[model samples]
Target: MTQTPALQMTDVTLEYPDGRDGTLRALDDVDFTAEVGTITSLVGPSGSGKSSLLAVAATLLTPTSGSVRINGREVTELTEKHRAGLRRDEVGLIFQQPNLLPSLTALEQLVIVDDLRGKPRRRARERGAEILDHVGLAESCSRRPHELSGGQRQRVNIARALMSEPSVLLVDEPTAALDHERSEEVVTLLCRITRERGTATVMVTHDTDFVPLTDAMVTMRDGVLSASAHRGSPDAGSTRRSDRPGSSPG
Candidate 1:
């Protein structure tokens, strides 16, 4: 039997009321999926509905029609309460901006989410420590956002998202603000974590440089997704010890 996809969107259509009180289809019949331990990249122009797709996949928006499945469970048919639960328990969203509270230390940024979820502060911090350490932020745990570099801040953001142990990860323009070097690092980190944790990751990136790092690349145009493509950049498949950060020799 075929392995079940970690995330699925089938014939999804999302519409909004135009200023003239007419329907505007932001997403039209979009079908997509991200399998376990795989990274899928979405590329498109502005207003091409990439963000909208992310929103739907994240369970932030219900589609006008069609289905969305998370971990093989159809979520589009779920009630808002159930959808909210799925969002909290199963989906990890990495926004374009780190959006970290300057007042909070890098570790605190992650523990707070657990606190909100009612986990005890002590346990939460322990979980935070494990996740941060996984992301190679062990030494910077006490540093605030300003104390860290842009790449480090993004690592915190990525770590925070993974704290939930999510089955699916939805990232929005994660490389929009960083320079080429930082951008590449962040993408590499994403690929590493996705494979390591067996999370199905769907990332929207404008930078084609990140394309080759993904398991598959799908282009979206005018709210529609095309067939699969690959960049074959050696990192396109599963991760290896060589692909791990700090593994390269100077």
Candidate 2:
């Protein structure tokens, strides 16, 4: 049987108003996809449309033209309410910063996410525990974000994203705030979770270290997509160590 694409973007374009002249194209005819049980890493220099793509995919920003689909459902044409529902039900978002509520405990964080999606808070509590454990943060459930380390906070963020068991995961610069070791650990954990949960994950980052851990690596330059040879196949544990230049030799 053929697999349904978890995400599909075809001929997508997004632009922002330039002060008094032409628009600035954030994404131009960029097409990409992530299948279930796989992770696709988007790497590029600053201003290369990486964040714009993530924003559009998360329904946080609308593209100027083209299609955005999740689990074979077209989201580009959805109303704001429907788009929000799609985001809540089908898409999971992880940001560079942990972005946790200072007042909410880790468990509360996940519980509230489900609550916001109209799911029963009690039903989500068990899922919250399961995902928190899956992400290696079972013991930190009652801790507030400030009480946890940077890496631990990020793990909570990841756990919160997965609490709904979304089919599509959108992550933006997940390792930007982490140290080298912590970043690697987070990426490895992400890869593991993507496979175990059968989530199609797309991560935007400038970190070259994670290039090897992904099922496929694609780069955006001048709002266009380009494939890279860094990732060989769609297997989760096929990483090989090599001396990547301009990368911290960790």
Candidate 3:
């Protein structure tokens, strides 16, 4: 039997009004897939449509002409309410910034999701502890965002996203605010957690250092996505260092 991809985008295109009597194509006929228990990274320069691809995948943006399938269910044409439920139940988003609540402690941050889901408070607390421990943030469960280090806060962000037990994870430039060491830690954790939980993860990052850690890496340029390649594949040479400033590419 053939397994369906956890997330799939076919011939996806996105356009924005360009002020004049024209449109700017953000994505052009891109076909992307992320399988269960795998992490796919989209690498490109700024304004390369990587985020647009992510938004479309997360069902946050409907494509101009294409299809988006999440867990084998077509979501492109779903009503807003249905899509919102889909997002809450099946999708997990990790923004570039942690965006954690300053008022809530680390564990409370995760428990809030359970509260919103109407789950029991005890189970929420227990589940929060479990995921935080998995992310190595258990010791900091009582700390607030301001009290934790940047990396610790990002860990909380990751843990919170996992609280929903989502099948699809959409990450936006996860390492944008992290240093080399912390970036490596977070990416490694992501890979491990994705495998352990069988989540299909699509992470957008300009940092080429994340290439080797990815199960597959794809390049996006000028609103077009190049076919992806595994690390051992012949096309692996396409994963090169980014010459952009502040980049210590591998």
Candidate 4:
């Protein structure tokens, strides 16, 4: 049997107000999807609307046209409060910056998330510990963000995103700040989580070095998706791995 896509964007468009009564199209009729239990990487230049696409999918921004669907629900037309609810309950976001609070400990970071959802803090702490361990940060749970390494902090961000059991995980440049080894490790972890948890993951990154690590890759340019690849099939990303620099043999 075939599975439904975890994320689905249909002809989504986003516009920003340009100066003096003009509009800039940040995203132009882009369509994409990430299936559950798979990882899809989005690659693009700095101003290619990658972030705008993510913000729209995450319900942080509304599209000017088209539809945004999560697990087959058309959320583009939802009210602001409903969109916020969808984000809080159905979508998990891993920002480029770890974005941990200075005063909160690693575990507290997640506990606070539950509080925001009107859940009990003690109950959330139990869930937080399990997720912290899942992200390999169980040992650093008590340490504050300032006390952890860059990679550790990123893991904290990942754990916090999953703390709510979201169906779709939206990750932004997770390895942007890490070195080569750390970046590879984080990428590997992301793949493992997607497979193990059966969650649909969309990762946005500039590094072509790790493209092979994902099940598929989509390249965006000038607010449009131009090239794409898929794994285990006749797609650009999987069939032509040897062509990529630093790609290891399967």
Candidate 5:
């Protein structure tokens, strides 16, 4: 049996009003999909619509036209409240910055996610501790952001995102603030967690060195997306453009 993709977008186009009558096209008829237990890296220059794509996938921005389905439910036309619920229930967003609260402990950062969902306090703490441990922060749970290293704080950010047990993970430049070694560690952790948790992860990154660590790579230019080489494919390390929009990697 064929399993449904965890995240899918079809003919998605997004536009913003320029001055008065003009409109800037941010995404142009893009189609994309991320299967369960896989990570798809999105690479492109600034202003190439990578952020726009992530926002749309997160249901934070409504597309001008097209269909966006998360776990097989169409969301483009959902009411604002419904969209918010969908985001809370099905999506996990990891921002470029850890953006941790100044006073909250690392474990508190994750516990707050469940708190917002009205989960029981005891259960929330148990789940938060387990997730922190999974991210290799078992001993740092009580430490504040100031006491943790840069990479450790980022791990807290990732663990917080995972607290909801979301099916789709949208990551935006997760390694931008880390050094080479830390970047490698964080990306490796993301790959491992994605596979273990069966989440479909789409990461937007500028670091080409780590692109091969992901399951597939896709590039965007002028709001157009094209397939790139898959990590383990015969043509790996080479760029390949698709004849049409939204071609699957390799």
Candidate 6:
């Protein structure tokens, strides 16, 4: 039996008004998909539209045209309220910064997700604890943001996203603020979590060193997606570090 992709986008295009006379296309007829139990790395330059694709996939920004399906349910036509509900129920977003509330403990951060969903407090706490432990933060449950290191804080962020039990995970520059070692640790943790939870994960990163650790890598340029190559495949070399204009290759 074939499994459907956890997240799919086809012919997606997003345009923003350029001054008053023209439009700037952020995503140009892009087709992207992420399968269950696998992770895909999206690599591109700063202005190459990587974040635009992610925003569209997350339903945070409506595309000018396209079809977006999460767990096989079409979301492009849903109302904002419905789309928000779908996002909350089916998608997990891991931002570059942990942005933890200074006053909230590590576990409390995860519990808040359940609170937003109206889940019972007891069950929320239970699930939050389990997720935190899964991310190797079992002993730091009571620590607040100030008490945790950068890597630990990121782990809490990952755990918090997992609290929703989402089928799809959207990560943006998860290692931007970490040292080389911490970056590798966080990416490895993401890999393990994706496999263990069967989540379809799409991670956007400027770091090419970690791309090979993902199942597949796709390069984006001027809003267009190149063909993806699986890790260790002959064509995988095509996904080499993007050399953006006026910038050194990553």
The clash tally of candidate 5 reads 0
Looking at model 1, report the run of 10 residues with the lowest lDDT sum.
234-243
- Candidate 4 local lDDT, residue 83: 87
Global CA lDDT of candidate 5, please? 0.89
lDDT of 5 by residue, 1-250 (tens): 9888888888788999989899999988887888889888999999999999999999999999989999999998899999999999899999999999989999999888888999998999999999999999999999999999999999999999999899999999999999999999999999999999999998999999998888888888988876665756422112223444475643
* Best candidate, lDDT: 5
Tens digits of per-residue lDDT, candidate 4, 10-51, equal 777788899979999987777677778888888989998889
lDDT for position 89 in model 2: 82
Candidate 1: which stretches are off by over 4 Å? 231-250
Candidate 1, 6-89: lDDT as tens digits: 887877889999989798888877767788888988888999988999999999999999888898899888889988888989
The window of 10 residues in a row where model 4 has the poorest summed lDDT is: 233-242
Task: Point out the higher-scoring one by lDDT: 3 or 5.
Answer: 5
True-structure lDDT of candidate 4: 0.85
**CA lDDT, candidate 5, residue 81:** 98
After best superposition, candidate 3 residue 97: deviation in angstroms?
Answer: 0.6
Rank order by lDDT, top first?
A: 5, 6, 1, 3, 4, 2
Q: Which of the predicted structures, 1 or 2, would earn the higher lDDT when compared with the native?
A: 1
lDDT of 3 at 212: 83
What overall lDDT, based on C-alpha atoms, would model 2 receive against the true structure?
0.83
**What are the per-residue Cα lDDT tens digits for candidate 2 across 1-250?**
9776888887788999989888999888776777898888888889988889899988888899988888888888889999988888888999889889999999999999888778887889988988888889889989998899999999999998987789999889899888999999999999999998899998888888777888888778877766654445633211111223343422
> What's each prediction's TM-score?
0.90, 0.90, 0.91, 0.90, 0.93, 0.92
**Candidate 6 residue runs with Cα over 4 Å from true position:** 232-250
Regions of candidate 2 where Cα sits further than 4 Å from its true position: 229-231, 234-250
